[model samples]
Target chain A: MTTGNPGPTSGPVRSEFADDAEMTELVQMFVDELPERISQLNEAWNSADCQRLEHIAHQLKGASAGYGFSVVGEAAAQLEESVRQAEDNLSAATRQFDELVDLCRRATM
Target chain B: MQQQEQQPVLLLIDDSPSIHRLLGFKLKNEGLDFLAAFSGDEGLELAKSNQPSLILLDLNMPIMDGFETLHALKDDPETIEIPVIVLSGTTKPEEKVKAFELGAMDFVCKPFDIHELRVRINSAIRISRLMRMLELRAQIDGLTGLWNRAHFNERMGTELEAAQRGESEIALALCDLDKFKNLNDTFGHPAGDAVLQGFAAVLNAELRSYDIACRYGGEEFAIILPDTNLEQARSVCERVRVKISERVWPNYPKLSATASFGLTHIGADGRTDASAFVDAADTALYAAKEGGRNQVKVYSELPEAGDGPAKLALAS
Candidate 1:
């Protein structure tokens, strides 16, 4: 869970509202924004903007679970924690950041 | 200051658009008027203008993070009393403690249970509303339902300060029921009470919406007119005077009441304390009483000292 790496048996992650007919459009909107969020995560990491990276991860951690993407939320939480505690060690935080981006890529409606 | 009951407003301050969208959808049926702000600066502005019942503040904003924003909110007189619930993505106990120290009413970690959040929000709004009601009750007069003398004193000082600061023009008027003692002795206490109540109603009806009318004491009242000059205030007081004189008590058909008013205006250059401001209006009121029982007298119209005999305008 701390590594934020998806297990081999884990399939494309669906929202908790995947089966909720009323939430179809909202859940789809969240899923549709995944690519943008993934790009944002990469931009923050590549630019070495640890503060921005932490903010984006923090937002995802708070928002993903409500959209029924608990896996992505967990990944985001792990990345946020690593960045917060990283201090001078940037390697570990970089690893968690990449793992979160992968989770966002695999998120589905 | 009794406010008409309306749907409570819930303001969410968060940098994340997704969080705003999600909460907007989830809390749509929670019987609240929802407002959203994407940054702390925007949130602070909205809080001052709207005075929302409850605030949901996110802790991880970019420039003005939750702690800084919380500190600012608690510091401002306008937004200090508002209850805030801090929402943080991290589950650190220290963050929770810090939020509470900053005057947050409650703290909810990320991935909060929707049911729990609803219950917490309801309880906070209920408690805040009750507190406000209690505060309002303390400042209101029970007999006439107008602001009590204590509230009037406080408001007068605030209005004077604002006027001196060049923010707005202000006027004050002191009103006394002419020959009130005669009415009380002749008609009895109960009848006197009815006239006071009737006078209060006339004041309420005649004054503009922003004008504040207060029960200064027995048989006397005070009015604070913000953003008004001498002519406007005199006109308003004249209307109230006429209304009081025309009012007829059904229980006592022969009963008639008239009130004398002293009006004073303060502009941006006016350098006066609350006492002096009040005294100016009181002097005008004395002139009104001396000239005639029913009339309006402006402070500026009083004769200069040692100039001549007091040349006061008598009511036609």
Candidate 2:
């Protein structure tokens, strides 16, 4: 029995941008910036700063694909939407938020 | 020499600044001018002022949201014609249907693919430019290449209202080519057509770009000169008349056409409405015919508008 490997969305999901030196530069910047952004995301989540978390997620969604991290962008987008929908229900929103944060961390790793 | 290509402007209305930064970074080098609005209200304001070639509206936004903004835009006379592509995170069919029903040209799901976004933006702009060309063709006179009567009337009403608000002087002139019927009857309709074409060329050459030059009817033209006084309008009319008098008709080389002009000025303080304004101009034109033709006549001295002895039927 053959099992398909889970894809590396943060890795080389697309080789189209691999050869693009400018895009590679952006990818490097994104990799360098990820830890700081993730820290900010965690801080926002811990403090119940829904607005800040949504904002960071929104930014990540827009920028990740440009830097060759399609999965990261998708995860960010999901987080952003969830935050928007979960404005009045913080307890129910916690699981979705935590799942996306783990997904982002794993993608970067 | 390289001609500078006009880049299409895309108005993006989304609440997220991250989306703005992302789209901007992706599209900045792609030969497009990106306009960003953080909210639907801000987007609507930008749409009204900038008149972007296309709009990429986010469905989920704060306050005004995408659907509400789209409705407002479609209802507005200035922006109703602008093409909007809905950008939403949800892939729900009902959402797409609602967007379409609200006059969205296309729907895009986020996070956006740069290539897909480019394609959709280009398609929307192309459709909008084509629609504008179609509207212009409908409003233009095929024969004289001037504005048609319907367009003229609409513009006249708009200009009159604008002038009223600005308290500015404006002039309207009604001109008729002398003995046009006789030329058509004696020298054939082709000769008459050539003269009409020649006259139109002269009018175009003599009038300002902002002037509303229209083929009001057969052998008759109406011109609206905004921010022009009686004397200024007369100078323009005289110049046009002289140019028409000197132009050699294409088929009938020896024949030259002379047009009689009737002009009226709406004073800075005066209150003549649209109907009265046009009537005064037509009456002034009748007076020009009465004054042995080929001359400019002011409506201030002419009999009451629409009650002049010289019927437009016998003006030639």
Candidate 3:
């Protein structure tokens, strides 16, 4: 299971570790879950609800990092940041949120 | 739903899109199908329906993490035989230890190589197949595909014990081919093989599946009739003897043969020894051969030949 270069928005979360071929293919199974999770995160952001957004972001962060998509995890972290600081810079937070979602999509791909 | 009707399923629970995509692509060609669940609840539901052969679970998730899922899986009898492998981003020693303690067969850290993952999955499947095969081999005879001597011993003991306990009677019959050696010598090795095969088919068709027929040796056969007495045993032996005597060798049409049978019954006294039952039957068999090549002899009225030991003998 060769994990190629991480996209610009995502860092190499999975590349640091070396696993046998069996483990590698197992990691590759994550491809199926990405789209639905990304949609859920998007829904969480659309509502501008900090709690649900943070919940979704945290999930993506933990899972994407495990699957070697540090970029997606980083994007999730930023999205979580916007939710945590929701009381300030509402518009700016929304823009940052959009960028984070895009980052997640690119990172996973 | 019928328990017997359930189809075995394999569940793949992971949160990464790329992982699922690649796996679906790789596994699609292998003739196995899998259901994918990104969350624990979804995985649990799929497991309930699919009853998978194995589970590949991811540790990190939004709600109901892999830890909880593994517990639920192991705790459920329906899913217990389904082996699980943890696919997680947590490379921590404690995490791996915890996964195994929770009954995961293996743990693989994230960004796994496809080749290695395939090998592990295949290995797990192979192990399960081997275990099932071993269970089957225990009941099957290796040589003639008929029940073996050991099976006969077990069935006889059980039947006799059951009969003794219930105040019932049981019958035993032993059949030895008459002049079998001469047939082997005249027909050569291949002809001898054909005889055995042909005899087995005839015996199989003549007897019910519940009737135990064992290849006692080179050309001998044994049958144990539960709930049967000496009269019934003689009747069954006659039917079988008639079938065997009537068979015409396809290649050598003129060739004809017969088998001598020994019949004995365990009386209501329930004191008949297991070995004695066989001994009585064998003695009757010798009588059948001595009296006539094609005949069924009962042990109660017959005298035992001075056949050395009291044990059942294979008269060479």
- What local lDDT does model 2 show for residue A56? 78
Q: What is the DockQ of candidate 2?
A: 0.37
lDDT of 2 by residue, B1-316 (tens): 1124478888989886656766777777767888989899999999999988889898877578789999999999999999999988778999999999999999988767889988888788888888978888898888888888999889998998898789888889999999999888889988888887788888888898888899999999999999988889999999998888888665676776899999887677666667877877777888889889999998775656446432331232
Taking chain A of model 3 alone, its TM-score versus the true chain A equals 0.67
Query: lDDT per residue, candidate 3, B177-287, as tens digits?
Result: 888889878877677767777777777888765577877777888888777766777788899899988988888776677888988776555456578778878888888
For residue A41, model 1's alpha carbon misses the true position, in angstroms, by 3.7
Please give me the DockQ of candidate 1 compared with the native complex.
Answer: 0.67
Question: Against the hidden reference, what TM-scores do the models get?
Answer: 0.80, 0.80, 0.55
Per-candidate RMSD vs. true structure? 4.8, 5.2, 9.8
lDDT of 3 at B186: 84
Q: Count of backbone clashes for each model?
A: 1, 1, 34
C-alpha DockQ for predicted model 3: 0.14
- The parts of candidate 1 lying over 4 Å away from their true place are A1-8, A42-49, A86-102, B48-51, B161-172, B178-190, B225-238, B262-272, B280-316
